[model samples]
Target: MLSVNNIAKKLNLKVAAGNKGLEKQIKNIDISRPALEIAGYFSHYSSDRVQILGMTEISFFERMLVDEEREDRSKRLCRKETPCIIVTRDLHAPLELIEACNQNNIPLLLTETNTTNFFSQLSSYLEKELAPETNLHGVLVDVYGIGVMITGESGVGKSETALELVKNGHRLVADDNVEIKEVSNNVLMGSAPELIRNLLEIRGLGIINVMTLFGAGCILEEKRVMLNVNLELWDANKTYDRIGLEHKMVKILNSEVEQRTIPIRPGRSLAGIIEVAAMNYRLQHMGYDAALEFNGRLNNQIQKNGGLNNDF
Candidate 1:
């Protein structure tokens, strides 16, 4: 649960009144304006969110002063389970509102930012902090600015391949356990946990510090995952995509990413292959597809030859 005090500290909010209720938990990320509630409309009022009092709502309170209803309305608004109230644009809370908040033990926060800007920033922060996340047993690396996650069986040499890529100047984001967070609808950010930020574990070499040995250039704090590389032992019986015309994809957090299956065999430079794959993926984004071009040329040649098999 997120506390009102934590949100205030994160957003650098000033405490105006009711500091006692700063420990109140904010169970919902959605904030409330409460303009209608100030006008005595409580039919669809939601009280389980942070309430924002902007100039408009303050104006409504000012008009209510003539009717001698400001204090009563403010009391009614703060009577519910409202987590906290934020006065934006550096606006001072009305004396009656402050009294109501203090009377009900509802935290009152003040911020210099405008209402719209403050809401946008706060919503984004809450969205990321409350995003869904999962962990995968693999290695995430940044190759040529592309985030690639290497996954396979337990003994598929994921860590070794990541180490090789690090030696070749690629930065490692995470090793062994990659904590992935879905920041947005289609974006997944990969990072290592605090306990294993710069550590890499190889089978024979045990554990080693990639940041200390290869400097800061060989490690990344976090990266946006763009591709997945699955390494498997070479299986001659199964047919692989030799021409690369057909591509595969993997889904993570409801987002699909381009996936490549690399068969590991003796004398094969896995690091070089992975690096080239990253570059090729970037090329595909840049409107250049070698496999598609090759297929188109082959079709053109076959049509020119009247679809006849020319085997000399």
Candidate 2:
């Protein structure tokens, strides 16, 4: 984990004689550029995690404070200690701002890059590092409450299958791009991105509204995945499962869900097969073990026939 302590130690190792700035002590950073107003907004809280992004191009930010005496409310909001303040774009710090920051012990970061790019990189890194392990994907749905995600080589009838499924009575969660988030432990929430919400595209049909064509019952905003049916083109020489024995799992967040691969071939109804697969998954979850039962019956028959080995 990258932390303020680590950054501080790195700074200590860098400058042989230079003093550490107030910005060096912050553990969590919030970036707000070209505005000191945010300092007044959340600055009252001593524990607040804030990083002010200052414009180095502006000279008006050099305002000074004659007396550090603060109001009673301000005193209560901010402790004697303050958070770090950062000035961007290699701008020179006015003596007043420097004095104020030094008095408050707020670390100041002065950099040479433009404010926009600096804040952008800071926010981007923090968000990526802190975000949950869910992904943004497109989901294919059907009438049987099956949450099938249509994914394959780009142009492989994924969205087309989903459009047909929706027309037949199933709902559409997200088209083109789906937003997946982990709200609680063990649960993965799936939703559609705003740009392509409730929309699906077919080769010849063009853009179509799932809700408008299929009615309200055919569109869903979000649903937890019960099974993952990977759609692959049918390979003539490739062996496929004739019986459900080996269990496949897809990991989402910290949880593992079941998976299956279905081959898409000419004259085959992929949407129907996907629905059936989902139904089979539900049945298995309800304590049905077809392979185990079949094996038990086979063993019993062998023993009854007096032809089984001693191991049986």
Candidate 3:
């Protein structure tokens, strides 16, 4: 839960009144523009959001001063579990509104930004702060600007492969436990925990600091996860996708990411395979598919041969 005091500190909001209610918690990220509610239309009023009072709402309150029931309406609106009230454009809250807030212990905040700008900024901040996140056991590395997450069973040499990539000019994002957050609907961001950042745990060598050994360029604070590479032991019975015609995807935090499964065996250079995989993924993003091009050329050759024996 995000507290009103934390939001105030983050947004640089000034406490206009009701300082005692700073500890109020905000459950929802969406804010409210209480124009209709302030005008006595509370049928669909939302009390879970932070009420934003802009120029128009303040003007309405000013007009309400001529009415004999102004204080009653103001108190009715403030006497709910509304998170807080934010007055944009540095507009001073009317005495009635402030009194109502004090009476109900509802926090009132002031901001210098205009209504539209503040709403947009605060909504974005709240969305990010309240984003859904999950942790996965994997090794995340950034190779040629592509974020690749390596996953497999234990003893599959995931860390060793990541170390080799880091030695070859790639950057390590996280090792072992990777915290992934869905910042947007289709984007998943990967990062390491504070205690394990820039640290890699190898089988024989134990824990080693990648940043200290490989410099700052070999480590990244966070990266947008683009690909998932699962390394598994070589199985002769299971045929791998040599043609790369079939597309694979892995779901992470409700986002589907392109995935590749690489079979590991003795004498196989996993680091080289992963590096090429990253580059190939980037090429696919640029609308280049080598497998498709090869298949097309093969079909063209068969057509030219008049359906002759096309065995290659």
Cα lDDT tens digits, model 2, 218-307, are 788777656677778999999988678889887777766677888888999987887778777777878987877877887788878877
Instruction: State residue 234's C-alpha deviation in candidate 3, in Å.
Output: 1.3
Model 3 spans > 4 angstroms off: 67-70, 307-311
lDDT of 3 by residue, 101-178 (tens): 898889999999999999999998888777898999999999989999999999999999999999999999999999
- Look at candidate 3 and tell me the lDDT of residue 227: 92
**TM-score of each candidate?**
0.89, 0.56, 0.90
Q: What is candidate 1's lDDT per residue for 186-219, written digit by digit as tens?
A: 8999999999999999998899999999999899
Ranking by TM-score: 3, 1, 2
- Score each candidate by Cα lDDT: 0.90, 0.60, 0.90
Give the higher-lDDT candidate: 2 or 3. 3
Residue pairs in candidate 1 whose N, alpha carbon or C atoms collide under 3 angstroms: none
What shift in Å separates residue 193 of candidate 3 from its native position after superposition?
2.3
Best by TM-score: 3
Compared with the true structure, model 1 gives a TM-score of: 0.89
Q: What are the runs in model 1 whose C-alpha is more than 4 Å off?
A: 63-68, 79-81, 308-312
| Model 3 pairs in collision | none
